[model samples]
Target: MESSSEFPTSPSSGTTAITNPGFPVSDTVLSGASLPSPPERTSSQGGGIPLSKTASNVSSHSHRQSFAENQRHPPPSPRTQRHPSFTQQAIQDLMNHPPPNRHQNPRYVGRDWRDVAVGELLQPDEVKWAELDMSIQEATKTLFQSSPNNVVLVRQDSSSKEAMSTFDHSDLNAYLLAVVGLAKPEEEQVALYRDISVKAQSQEEIPLRDLQPIFRKEELVKIPAESTLDKAIEVFGGGVHRILVTNKDSEVVGILSQLRLLEFFWNEAVNFPLIDRLYTIVLRDLQIGTQQIIAVNADAPLADALFLMSSEGLTSVAVVDNGHNVVGNISTVDVRHLTNANSLPLLKASCMHFISVILSERGVEHGRDSFPVFYVNPYSTLAHTVAKLVATQSHRMWVVESASPSPSAPATPLLQASSSLPPLSTLSPPAISPGRTGSPTPGSATVVVPPPGAITTSTPQSPSTQGPFSSVPASALPGAGLSGRLTGVVSLTDILNLFAKSSGLRPLDPSEQRARRRRSSSSSVRPTLDIGRENGRGSVDSRR
Candidate 1:
């Protein structure tokens, strides 16, 4: 990947008005662009007072013209108007007409945002691949082992070399749902699958092809690798989480995730004065993200949180307690823990307990607590938020109210455990044994593993015993001192959208687009006025 300092020179500056090819012109006038003139009307057509006609005739003619003109051309509907501001127009023009020599320009300098290409910032694609004939167990293992924890399934005999589908956390959720005998009824599953019936089965023997219904076959959003960063931002502004970077032949070369984009911006922020200014603004002043939060109770079954994620189309959900304090977080990525035979029973564990187990697993597997609790307050600066997001590799940060520290109490780390739950460092490694089969029955004993060096009790403790916030003191819970009540959730998408808006290129609202489409369809069916000359006379004909 190209470093921030290696970018080429920005496009030359000028007052030259350039046409935007692919981007839709917004409903407001762009800076430096001429305002469009209103539709033309004729006095003879009754649009204005007829100078050659009688007073009575003029009155009636003007009324008719006004109605006809209004019907034919509505007065600059917001959907049809062009509203690209000066900054947006400049960015679009830059993208439409780039310099001939991207690297050799005499004025070329490092870290010029305008000259950066999506391909220049793209990192190596870490996505793994699996054959359709691969067993679910093998595929799951491969997926978890991969960095991004996703796999592309392809046909062995296919000639196009295109991926048949993708398998990710969502697919794992479905498979696990079936394994636990909690698969949705056939009627409810209709929208998810076509013909295959998913049922509780052994992952070791089932080929991925048999579970085609669970594969994500949605069309992958892609962009040309050579496209400018502005174009990528435009696509992302439409709510896409990531886009596949494609080469000239349309073959996907790399993936640009929301996190990766933000990381790049954070790294190169010093080079761009505008971005640096944006970073200093507090989140409350910008009000960038949605206030509505979708969360799961910390005491709810871990599976419930995963199901909620799948249903709500969320990558993660805030795990909160009864008072709505964010206690922890659970994400689709955590589903990887279930692939282990020893961890399968955690499906029915409380979300908090499940979180503890996953944290412990991370320490054992990766030698540290990979999952860190991250939160920010409304007063937090955008720079702080971005720094935390990039540092933790988290898609979001829980926005909590700023808590007033007590004079008597000393400050504690954000991840500090309350008396109810043991500290993460004291957790021991989970005991992995062989011969585990089928999903654990209800009321089965769930072993909560602590990190190495933790004291273990002789008697095995259930997940409920391990950690349930109901009995814990409020003052002892995580975020008790440094954070307050949960207010909202800010995500990577929100930050990216803000950047796009700052450039005067606001994301197109889906609802507005839908309304525009409706109006267009309706107009196509409406009668249109066709003017023609016949028999040495002018006539207006209404045609559908």
Candidate 2:
């Protein structure tokens, strides 16, 4: 893993001495927020995954298992000394890149969501599209080579007379599609959607439209181009992970994403501190503390896992046993490699099946049993949050039950029955009853429950018992192979949202507020650090 010292430094700082390429200046100091004392950095063996604690004289199979786990999450080894303060050059560099058109620039300025218009930072051009009749194989190729966004917009073939008009407001519903990928540990490939079918022994071309998942208009999170950033944040905090920015015509123009927003705030936090002090804040004081835990069963089909992630706009999901104990976790990246040219089962296979396959392929008995899981107590400080993200290069961490009823007995596992959903092919057509216009109205689709034992998952034991996974000691696995009940999740996006809502950069004065109002009347105004939100007008308007 890259050392924190290796973190990229701002290019603007001229006077700050360069210690090394990745390390920040060690002795530089500034003033404003009360910075906490730096904690001693410890060295671990893996990058993100926890290591297995096998006995030194373990079997060759145990050695291979240990080796595989380290490959996935290599422990860290200390490389550089910790820096005590921000360099003068770094501070000066930040000052030079002042936020556009601010009424006042303080040593620390808290910016609000309303100040910037959605149009200014909009990225409509990033949306990738495919033809309605395009083959799933072709779409997968397009996504792997050119698109990084999660969803693909499917449009009618250009050869048709009305191809251009197919993008009209009404057509938005028809174009929404999500891609699914591999959901097992140790497995890696380009990502593809769950509904795309590939025969077990042969590659068949499936129509992209056939695999498109229909989501209702109301189910989507959207914000007007004229809405404030705070409004976008409001929607995000309300459980909408991604917000589609629409114009006056209600056409989707761009997307305001949680991850991107969080990244922006993290950059600001590093650059815009009012004082030299590292601000001390805890999760209990942030918005993320109140979020409810969302998890999936360990034996759920890989397709279901992908659907939940794409619909909720999450990068990862926690895997829980029937007792609600988190057994593992799967992220978008974990499943990304499934797009490989190899013939592998996807939609119909359970997550455990994928893990088992990966293990078998790697000559390891079972990798899933030892997959690393990390958790943080809700009351943990933001400092620790930043530290973990940096140290592990991970996207998010789980908030687990701080105290368990019994260490021997794991916390309540997710009910095994929850994994009973069938492959996307078997899911009853979304319950879109016919409407007044004689067309099916786009809305919630109730899935028909299958009979008991109809949908089954692979058992915890591997089909092969001769492998090393069988001989490894139980203590070698993460959290003793049992996770506490999940309480919440904190991602890089959540951290940024908290910072955007909390960082008090500078207060707006009456005269400055009046100037803002005057400017807003003529043009869109970016948010400033104004706390007043009286009478629902918000601080951006005339300070109520």
Candidate 3:
């Protein structure tokens, strides 16, 4: 296997705009580049109006009271004690001593806010892959072991710069659906063979080309090696998740991923006091993570939702109603319940069919229960947002509002969690039917929930009792619902972006900008997250 590759720090070349319909135009552009007009928005889409920075005075008062009350009496939970001390300490150190050259990419030197380049934030990409000839089962297993994010790169030469044939996460899923019977089959024998031979031999012969999108040179969006991180973020602003980074020869040097960018932002926020300093910030002030809501109707088959997420490279998708009311959310974390078990019977079935089996079958798994989606209001302060994220221990929160009912009838309040419900500890993980022969029984195989919430807090008797940053008690988020409809999303990554942008909100003194420029010129390589060493431990598990 190849080790992580490094590239030169030269300034990136030209900037390119994303053509995806879902994204907004970036606020900043490369020097001399004309800023593209932002796409217009419909009310349902939540884009037209400028986000308000000032929280209502009443909201301020209520927030103050809530904070004071929490300071007076803190709640107790097992999660707090389990937080990795190294993570906490590293953040604290970063807060006190932010590196003089905090920006990781050096290509941004001499650049103003509008001229800021995307290359500054670019890092050597880390992604998983499988050749087309590999079996699905083998690829899936190898992918999860090293890269739990579970989106594998299907390529002939994954690192190749030239025309690369590919199939994404969605293709793998669509294929699974076909083989398992939800999707129509091309031929009876092919389907039957897949069912028998695939399960029996654990391999398949078809190349990935059958499912790959037609390769077009223009389809592969590339950026020069020296483009600013701002340009990259703008490219992402168009809902493009990953972009190809290239050198003068147009040879691919690295891949920039939205997930990596978000991770970088989150890590930076933790290292700095930006969260506290910018407590008054609102959703309007920062770049929302996902431009268009990658949503599915609540009534849609779970298979459909999975396919959407897989195709979009999203871990979760909002479950909405015909009226566009955000109802619930389903993510990879929920999918884990099925994937962890002997899911031969469920893998190919509609989500409804599979959900039924889990709810009604035997051998109940401890942590595989389904749960409602957690949300935040668009008008809520960043302080409140961060509080909810920390309190719930969540990676992302849905932003929604109560939609106006039709003119024909009286309005009704949006759905709310009942205060009378029992504690989470009382809820059991749903049951699922046993697996085929050789499948691990509930007692034999240890199952772990995947992504966003994969960081385990404790060895629980039941997994359903908690989720990655599950619902914050209603009391904890007092007045969060006052803000209106689903506008945009603010994830842990957005929080980091806010911190990064906050630095640019005020123009740097020429002296300060010059100092930064000098620092960038002298910087050799950016510091890396040395997980094992940082934690003073050796094994990955120990670091966790």
Candidate 4:
């Protein structure tokens, strides 16, 4: 909710003006090849217990009558049941007398979720590591080089065996705050902001251990490898981003992220009828995610946006124009670009320019504009949202007001079900120019202003201009067509939490400790120990 007007537009002693380059469009297009195909349905697979035809023929009237009869004479408890396995018996009971609206049940529909184990969803490659004494610059480079694995476990020193903390993109906010001198006393903070060029030079030498007060070094959530998927869901629903999987010896085995679990649900949805059905429900009907949005103006200094994210404990902030329309997005992940010495001056650039530079850098590095523009509207289906998240490899989606009018529901609610899962390429709407009234056409070229007293060039530039501080047109960007005001943000956590809630699973309270379950003596399935050690820190080479 911070406004651009609250911050000064230019430095007090310098005549250099921060010019507003039009919004840069994201050029990345999602490809379906990356998404796993939905697995074929089978009776025994995915915890599905096939019901007999006779059982399926029972009408709702008889179901209600049976419920009343059960109320009069309650059935025998599990202890007295014929089935030896309590879990099997419970699943049988659920299958025999399904809830009228299975969506309301605490268990997954058509599947015995207890059969799924936490080890099945873990990706060993995601485990990266860093040392406490490593300079922020070196750590930043390590994190960026690690790619998809955004977090790294931190050790106290090279000789230490156990990880003492964690460092991720979110921690970059604290580093940025230090660079701008915002962590200093209020009297000294103003002077630091006035001349950021001098302060940026000193930040690289600071070590990771120096920012311990602001770093999210809390104990990583741990779960036994043998634990059920439902337990993982419960922990994830509680707002934990990733959980470390451990073995009987209490050593780390692997890591499970919220995105990985969501991907599991997405790829295997066909086997779980309830989850598959839930996917068709539009975001508005489910009422998932928070509407309390934290954002910054497109013209605000990139440093200001990072400060807002750091102070508010947010991973990303929506960039909006004076009219409140979402023009761009800035997240902690983008902070990786600032670690490069040449890109450091961008801290003083406008957020819009920062986004432009990011896209340009990515376009050059990847040989294509691969940074996706992630946003959704009320009418977007849960399946669409999940697909986009997985496809873009992003953590959240900005909820924007739909440019079109709301559609009326069909006579049969089930008819609203999507015939097929929409591809990620279809999620991005057409690009529309973003800014105050009378904005340029979507095809208009980006305008870049030179530094004070710099000579202006007369040469015409291409639509896809590349530079350290130049902007690109909407036509060349992938997500430029997402037009409307941002309403809220739906993160991977929000989506996972919704699934947990619909399954009747309660979120683990902060005060409650997650009990780690041990592998049963009767089971012979032993999880493979895949934890890797490298450079005196634990790490795994990720296939992603």
Highest TM-score model number: 1
- Tens-digit lDDT track of model 4 for 259-295: 7788788767666765678877888998887676656
Model 3 TM-score (2 dp)? 0.42
Across 96-193, the per-residue lDDT of candidate 2 in tens digits comes to 33333434334225654345455655664865567878765555444433222344444576433211111111111111222212221111211232
Q: Give the runs in model 1 whose Cα sits over 4 Å from its true position.
A: 1-114, 148-160, 185-204, 215-218, 365-371, 403-482, 510-544
Residue 537 CA displacement from its true place in model 2, Å: 14
TM-score of each: 0.59, 0.44, 0.42, 0.58
Q: Give one digit per residue, the lDDT tens place, for model 3 in 1-544.
A: 0000011112124412111111111111101111122234323322223445776544434334354565565554332233223433343233234334645334323334334344555455544556666554455444444332334555565554442423333344444444333332234334342443244233334444433321110123456656655555544443444556666675555666655565444344434343335655665465454434555543344556665544334545654443334444555544433332234333333332332232221112211221122455555555555544443334466676432221011111111112132211122223323552211111111112222213446431311212211222211222222223444466654554444455553221223322332232122222211112122222211110
Ranked by TM-score from best down, the candidates are 1, 4, 2, 3
lDDT per residue (tens digit) for residues 365-438 in model 1:
33322334456778777877776676556678878776323111111111222212211112122232354322
Model 1 worst lDDT window (10 residues): 1-10
Model-by-model lDDT, in order? 0.51, 0.39, 0.38, 0.52
lDDT (Cα) of model 2: 0.39
Candidate 2 Cα outliers beyond 4 Å, as residue runs: 1-113, 122-125, 145-148, 157-204, 213-227, 246-253, 270-279, 285-287, 290-315, 320-327, 340-374, 386-396, 401-487, 491-544
C-alpha positional error of residue 365 in candidate 4 after TM-score superposition, expressed in Å: 2.9
